[model samples]
Target: MNQQQFEKMKHGQGFIAALDQSGGSTPKALAAYGVPEDSYSGEDEMFDLVHKMRTRIITSPAFNSDQIIGAILFEQTMDREIEGKYTADYLADQGIVPFLKVDKGLADQTDGVQLMKPIDNLDETLRRANERNIFGTKMRSVIHEPNESGIKEVVKQQFEIGKQIIAAGLVPIIEPEVNIHSEGKEKAEEILKEEIRKHLDQLSEDENVMLKLTIPTEANTYKQLIDHPRVVRVVALSGGYDRDKANSLLKENDGLIASFSRALADDLNANQSDKEFNTALQNAVDSIHNASVNKK
Candidate 1:
């Protein structure tokens, strides 16, 4: 691991930018960016358009290290270049750390949750990410209700993959998101916390990891996890919440910072002028940054 990047990740005061929309989510992401479904006929064209969108966002003055500590990227984006430099290298140049989304998306729901699909060639992926100066990886799983066995299984899979990532010398953002609209949301969070604590306790003193969770039903639900010796940081996923609501809930939790996707891109439109785009992005960044570091 790069010590400088590690120090920045451990101490940085801003949120991470989630720009890792994969094949499953790319169409939705692009449509929201004002590109209709008919705009592209195939996967290649779709990816090209999304890459352009990502490039525009990355190159924008509003997207910078001052308010963004890191960015999580898709595999395609990681392999692509920005202004004659690799995506991760460009982020590093701007003083922002880069991470890759390492999972192969979610498997079919079972046991009230959806775990990650088996990742093929994970070792090769991690090797490539490391070679590109990437500092970490993010993978996601989802829980719909408080099924103890299901939640336990989700966390278990996450840690197992996380250990693999760690062994490859990269931090893993272990994310087991409880569905924001789950009928038994609070109870689910409780079970999720217990499972996470068990794993954190098992980690060696020298091992460090990050957690990405949904904003809990109650404030400070992950307080112990936030302060855990093995946890480097704990970030919150927007999880379908609008920007205002997500930030509002985030303020109620003291240590967690944002790693928003849709919320971050909420007001941005493909047709907006550069000035308008930057203004909108700056407003979102400021609000999220305030909620992150200037707790209510």
Candidate 2:
């Protein structure tokens, strides 16, 4: 999008809740919530639960809180409605920007690192995002270790695709996620930061980008990025950390906000009583909200 859009997001001072897991992740999440394997047999069945989750978030006070300015939605949820309103529209009405996950999932490993599946027809995807009034998009690629060459390759590819997304008039959240449990996590982040710098350095002074990074070992590893002219925001992924630990780590980082999936919904499961679910979600939201406001 334009600088104004990015500026609005920056001013919002919040994180993104990544509720866009698809396929296996969807069922796994449901099952964790005590939904039985036999509970849902198809994509439609699984999506019904997702929609309900969105509904909960939208109608809850947490959704209206200033701690969250946007949400990342699965393609299925893009057109889905809750309470007779399109999900995206629902988010917009609440002042939360809607962003779509456009990657096709992981492809074959490249030098022991898994790259994101190619965007088969990105123009069409962007078209849908546009029509849905989505404010931005997120794509993910994985870095397994501190393999400099592999990390560089993944970052390069991410930026290449990101530029195209920017050209399409939508902000792109370039997510080159480093495995948190991988060895040499700190060094890996250093390498990834350098690679990202290469891409940012190439952008014209007027161009802007946003990053969805894994929380680094060093709290301020991304300070340079936070200060960069073309960098709008630097957000972190939970990267499978539990909600408490995720928030604890996130709070230590300066100028980094969250875009969490598992952590954001850690306590939300199918088994919880409605009251219990709301309490758990509220607590989770509070932690993330507090961390986002601590902008370092």
Candidate 3:
């Protein structure tokens, strides 16, 4: 592990940017940026376009470690380059830590939750990520209701994979997201917290991990996790919230910081000139930064 990057993540006063839109979510992400489905001919062109979008964001003057400590990237982005350097290397050069999203995607919903599909060649992927200078990895699971067994399975799978990532000398961001609009959202969060605590307690003193959760129904819902000896940081996903609302909710949570994807790209448009795009991105970065570091 890079000690400098680890320290920055452990105590950095900024938010992480989630730029890791995988195959299923790529079209939606591109459409929001003003690229319609018809604009691309096939998967190749689609990924190429999304890569351009990411390159633009990374290269913009508005993005830097000052207010953005790290970025989570799709596997394709990790394999590609920005300005002739591998994506992770480029992020490091700009003082931003880079992380790769390693999960294939969600599995079919069962037991009121969707666990991550089994990741094939995970060790190989970890090796490649390490070779490219990535600092960590992020994987996601989803919960639709407060079913104890289901949520337990989600967390278990996460930590199991997390250990693999750790053995490879990288930290893992274990994300088990509760659907924001679920009928028993608060109840689900309550169960989720307890399950996470059990796993955190089992960690060896030298081992550490990060958490990326949905913005809870109540403020400080994950305070214990945030302060856990084994937890390096706790970040919140926007979970379909708009930027303004996401920032508002994040402000009420004292230690949690943002790891927003759609919210960060909400105001940006592909047709905008560089000046316009930069200004929009700057505003988004500023608002998220304040919400992350200036908690109410």
Candidate 4:
């Protein structure tokens, strides 16, 4: 990405709506949203419901407003059309940048850490994303505890992957999501911060990178990273928190914004009336936008 494009993304509304649920997680989300398991076929039903949810957000006024600056889309939904217009085109028309989730998924655990499964055909995937006018890409890996060695390996791998994406002329959202329910969350954040700095410190001055991390237990745990010269912006994932709690926590840290999936989509179901769905989306967007502005 060019410097001007990077500035637009970094300084925009900071609240990124994540609609990139993979096949494995989509079924559970559908059920949680009150879609009965036997209502339709198998994975197809799950994706269909996900498509409906994406359509709702894309059609909402709140989503078209400045409350949401960017959105992440699953591969299946990225190219789909709304009202005969491509989803990416619709988002760009509304001034909300579109991002694609490029990681395959998580792999088996090693040393208590779950590494993100590398994309098998990343070059072609990135080429398609670029052709589709995607603004960025996000990939996820998991951190279970504050193991220094494990954290270093995770950081190394993430940065290596990020380098490839950056070289492909697209921004990368490096996500090493810490399990919120794990013990010693505070210590884990400290370790994660150190590992991040270790890799960032080695980067050339022009190699700007972005991070999408789990909310830290303490407000200033990631302050150093937010201020790092090579770090463009720092964003937080909702992890397992609900919208209310997630917003509350997001406000505790300065320079942190949200890239929330479940929290952003909370309370809307396939059964809601149009008015009800719109109300839910508006309330969620308002809260998340307010939190992003109140990050201090």
Candidate 5:
């Protein structure tokens, strides 16, 4: 889709999920999950597999085919190949839109979120991708402030960050969450929803309304977050490295989430244990599909 088309997505309710494929996630398995093998863990050997998975998604009547596959092109090893395919001609040849995710994640001064800090190298990365004719992009900025000041800080920082991006012609996914738990986790999700809405509304004025968002299932159910009119989309990010819980959450939400992914993908990317990771991912997909069918 074009930039204008993407901007119009704000009117489309329900969340867009970032399909989770991390931690020893094999291309063969991702193929089974409906993502092209070439799309992740890049290998010419699995090009056919990737093609098959994508084709299935496109043809699947049960699943939303506009589904996004996250972290596919983010790997440094895969950039060279993917960027080549992002060119205008390459786009025409492929006949598919790639939603690039850019996020300058949180910094706790230590720990996992902090360690990944100065995240998503958004500016320079998108510049290169845009030059490669890679147009549509999504930036997921995770801010760690759990109180009002943190909320305000996230709004200001994300706005400044987003203004720079929209000017350069890329979409930003404004994701400011209180990690898995924060001072407010004990409060209610409305606090999180309200905080997110404020950020999004403020960011909405940044150049255009093209900024897409990923609202966690935790936040929603914790406070019945989906009730917000401003929350145009929902995203279920895998949590605590548990597939059963992740799948259970997916079923609980009734396909409201359009995307799903987690740190497991990081583990997969780094060549970590793929056994438990793959099993969890499969359960999530199965649960989501079952939930979609029976509304369970």
Candidate 6:
């Protein structure tokens, strides 16, 4: 993501950020990022994530008191592992919001099957959340993977998911992730930009989504899928290693970038290294700084 693109995104239209696998490094990394963190981690890990959220809010120049700090529990919620009744209440107690990752994503179910498959505990689980009063609910779609869909499944799923959430009165995180990881941040950004275009094709006149968990940052393939009219009310996502890239991506589009590491439960190294996450962010900031100095 670059300055021009960053300038284009609508501000305060927050993006979702992910925690890297390091159970401990998130807060320090986000502080280095100069942005607030919104996290998604396991039940045991809330201690660390909440601390990260609080510290980022207190210290970062970007902190907004009105915004939320939260996490997405895909494996736990989908598998019926969370104690939904008190979980939301518990998170609020810690100054964190909780979201149920409603999208079913996996390679085998790629085209259409994934989106149509009802959330494992859809109606009942949300009811539990509402009763307990969790901050909101988020759902995603596994649309256009290795096989792009002319079948129009993303839009179909979008309508279905949006309607359901509206009925339930939960804020929907509509993330249609084409998150095929890449070592090159620019390449990753490319893939994401295209993914954003594809997903946004579903946006209607009313444009019902509360957010797009991931928005494209790199320019590489973004233009390939660029046909949508903006439907996302806000934009954000959580991923590992892209805070700065994520920062640049959102800045270009004039949107928000919420923080998360891809899946820190698995990567012990990334979890511990603040340097890793901040490098891209630092590079991004430096680029802007250099450009500003040059302009002057």
lDDT of each: 0.95, 0.82, 0.96, 0.84, 0.43, 0.43
In angstroms, give how far residue 127 of model 4 lies from its true place: 0.6
**TM-score: the better of candidates 3 and 4:** 3
The clash number for model 4 is: 0
Tens-digit lDDT track of model 1 for 1-296: 98888888888999999999999999999999999989889999999999999998999999989989999999999999999999999999999999999999899999999999999999999999999889999999999989999999999999999999999999999999989999999999999999999999999987889999999999999999999989989999999999999999999998899999999998998999999999999999999988898887
Sort all candidates by lDDT, best to worst: 3, 1, 4, 2, 6, 5
User: Which digits, one per residue and each the tens of the lDDT, describe model 2 over residues 109-162?
Assistant: 777478988789999999888888888889999888788898988999899998
Structural RMSD, model 3? 0.6
Tens digit per residue, CA lDDT, model 3, 1-296: 99999999999999999999999999999999999999989999999999999999999999988999999999999999999999999999988999999999999999999999999999999999999999999999999999999999999999999999999999999999999989999999999999999999999987899999999998999999999999999999999888999999999998999999999989999999999999999999999999999988
lDDT, residue 91, candidate 6: 40
73-154 per-residue lDDT for model 6 (tens digits): 4324323322333444444454445556555443356443245455666777677666655445565554344343522565
Which segments of candidate 5 are over 4 A away from where they belong? 1-72, 75-78, 82-96, 109-122, 133-145, 181-183, 186-188, 203-232, 262-286, 289-296
- Residue 28 of model 6: what lDDT? 55
lDDT, model 5: 0.43
RMSD of 2: 1.7
The segments of candidate 3 whose C-alpha lies over 4 angstroms from its true place after superposition are none
Task: Give the backbone clash total of model 5.
Answer: 18
Q: Return the lDDT, model 2, position 2.
A: 34
Give the better candidate number (1 or 2) by lDDT: 1
Q: Which stretches of candidate 2 lie over 4 Å from their true place?
A: 1-5
TM-score of decoy 5: 0.56
Q: Model 5 over residues 32-122: C-alpha lDDT tens digits?
A: 4545544555455454343433333322332232322222233222243433443233322443334455553345632212222454566
Measured with C-alpha atoms, the lDDT of residue 233 in candidate 2 is 84
